[model samples]
Target: MPDLWQNICLHILLTCPIFVNVWSRHDHLYMGLDHRHHHHLHYEKDNDLSLWINEMQVKMFSGFSMKIFAIDNGKVSPHIKDPNFSMYLPTIPSEVSYVNFTWKSGAKKYDYHFDRLQSLDENILKPPSISIKTKGRVPRNPKEFSVFLPCSGNVSGVAMFSIGLLIQTRKGKPLPGTPLRLTLRKECAHRGVYDRASLTASQGPDPECDKKCANNGWCNHEKICQCPEGYMGQYCTQALCYPQCQNGGNCTAPAICSCPKGYQGRHCEG
Candidate 1:
């Protein structure tokens, strides 16, 4: 009996390592033991017919990544990078819709399905703006994109203006440009014809204009408009008179002029 017991103990010890290894592998296969939690699925309920995703979460796996796609009425929306990304849905007759989430782990796949409530808001269904022309390659370096306005008439009473150009890639670290293009879009009117005005940016305006307007004036291609002290107007067309004169007195380009009891000059100094 002692010899038999000895033999049994030896057999058990020899198989212990093998059993442990098999159990570990099985756990990995069934419980994602070897895989990291790479992505998450989340949804929201709405009172209307359109289903919108209000939150999403995701993480990177050791050797894998994840993407999300939303399908509505049999049409697939664009793939979103994160589950938290919000989605706006179109109006539908039914208040509830179906959503499916497909998760891929290496060669393995998992799927989840849920019923999502849709709150169809007419305001949310309005199509995004497709009118802005965003063509041409975005500059690799600090390149200037400009719009030319032909006449001052086009700019007057403009109230607001904006233009957008698409950016393609970044070569080095990205620093936002002043007059950042993204924020400028909101200030622009949705639809309006603007008179052509040429826009260019450099260290300074044309060298000739710089030299011409050197003494506090603006040099145009054809002429220079010297702005007078305390006054700024088109071609010096108008004057800035402060402490405007009352009682029929004309204000000069800078100072207020009190005319004789009968006559009024721009500057009462007259």
Candidate 2:
């Protein structure tokens, strides 16, 4: 009877599925079997949905890059080649909205972000902008004034004084490091008095003063020196005596003549 019972048990084991756990401490036996079919059955229903969500998340965080341009006087001008990843126009005029931009990536093309017209909150990604305006008058002469001379002592106080007068008369502000041209006039005499002519003084003259004399009859503000009569030039070096002292009995000095018997003043006036 025992052998028969053992044989029946073996038959039962072969007929029914057998399960055995390599390691188990519980009285109930732990089962191990191929669960691939059950796993597939549970996953099939939600596979499409999960894949779609992953794809959407990837596209959402892809970020955006853009370029900015300026539209002025009916002409479109490229202002910024490529701006930040995303651009928002805070205070752009409505007319400027008409300005077109072509977004390109691979073989795709899109218009301005406004065309997409996503959710209002999503579309409004940038903040409002602020603008400021400032204005000032244009200056007539931007360069500074300079006084150059052959020598530092060449420019006399009188020359500087005269230059001050000229500047004052013209209401001009003198600046430093500016170039000035000193030109002697043809007619040296004005109002019956010989007005020793001097040019606008500059910072420093080239070659410096070779001769020892004040520039013109004017004394330099820095170096005040009286010009000797009849000796008139930038440095009182050139004798004013010229044109052979016309009608002179004897040419004593520049612009001066000593008359004979009947002659009187300069030019030997009879």
Candidate 3:
């Protein structure tokens, strides 16, 4: 009773009824996996093994052939299931775009000085609407990125970050099931026992961009306008809206959806 093209791979499911997720201890980042629908072999399955990284490597488990261990601290125990996912998998995108995320806390301000943002091909990424902040900056080489809160005076704890992004096709159309949020938690140690990066500026704004920069964004060393949230382009002229305008919805500003008469909801999918 299988379809004409679904005969052989039917018996061979990606994961059996039960599965265990992989583990990580590398002090890099946190990522979340929004589940995708899988009706393989005509079975409604949500227990397939998820993917993760360890020691800066894309972990490859042939099947659900990994062991998952749990550690509880007070009321915090981590889980790896896509609990609230309800969408089909999208086709592969030709390009990936990461929105530069910056955070401001308390009275402390940070200026992340980097040469240029690199193009990363991460398997998972969050959307533009999600708040992805970071406490530190990898000024030289950025491998994995996440959101973090600024800690001061050797104050150490833990934080989670989701580097949201957009996936687009060759002709520049936003793919569906996108703006996927990836979260990773980092445990920080107290001072005198850890490595640290100078995230905050000891001085004032760069003279090159003090008065030249437009909008509320900062001017980096290269005199480029590091635009504020909900904006993009070299000069931050274009407002960004990921999963761009569906059902003829007009996106006048960042994440601001202008639905037509017959459609509603953000991105007008509802």
Candidate 4:
């Protein structure tokens, strides 16, 4: 009876189909297991999702040894061959932008690459600084912005890059180690400056519009200056009738000629 039971157990173990459901705890969404090489590989699921690893790849036989290993793969896609690349940052006169990055180099030198200029916000869109030409030839200023790390392949050094436009006119120098994150967003359908007008004709939080008028003038919905009683001109910077009454003439309306006893007509012209 013991021998018959042993044979029955052996037959069931060998003949019955085994179904294993494996859930991965790794950060990667898709992975592949090579049966012949006994290794695991990380696969990008964007372009080649159809060739992704199926449920059969993660299974393990009862007698097979399972090895756990992780590989750091930074390559985003197969088509882009460059692991390290150079980026030519845009130039603007007296304007400076910054980028925060990590650097790890065993080779003599490596470059930071950029595909194109993109922005996440359209209202804040400004032209790149690198494209602008300065009044004089700019001197070659090499900035020491990188933090050095001890010799370790696993460790990386953080660094900052400062893109200079106009150094003198800048509000202040940028703080080290801080970087501006760049992104690309869809273009806005409506052109020109964006402005939100309320029922009382007050300005809303539309970032594109700005109040550049001087004195008590208000910036209208079209971005034009709405001069107050005493102010005038495009930016409301000029006084309508200040000291304009030459030769002892009494000042009245803006740009209106108010002549003295001997003078007459506009500006008190004789």
lDDT of each: 0.24, 0.24, 0.32, 0.26
Best by TM-score: 3
Query: lDDT for model 2, on a 0 to 1 scale?
Result: 0.24
Please tell me which predicted candidate would have the highest lDDT against the true structure. Answer: 3
On a 0 to 1 TM-score scale, where does candidate 3 land against the true structure?
Answer: 0.30
TM-score against native, each model: 0.20, 0.19, 0.30, 0.17
True lDDT of residue 127, candidate 2: 14
Q: Is candidate 1 or candidate 3 better by lDDT?
A: 3
**Per-residue alpha-carbon lDDT of model 1 for 239-263, expressed as tens digits?**
3333344466654434445465865
lDDT by residue for model 3 over 55-164, one digit each (tens)?
Answer: 21111111122222111111011232243221111221111122233222112222222222221221221111211222232122122222212222244444333434
Give lDDT for model 1: 0.24
How far is each candidate from the true structure, as Cα RMSD in Å?
28.8, 45.7, 20.3, 30.2
Q: Which rank order by TM-score, best down to worst? A: 3, 1, 2, 4
Compose the digit string of candidate 4's lDDT tens values, residues 62-87.
11122111111211221111122112
lDDT of 1 at 156: 27
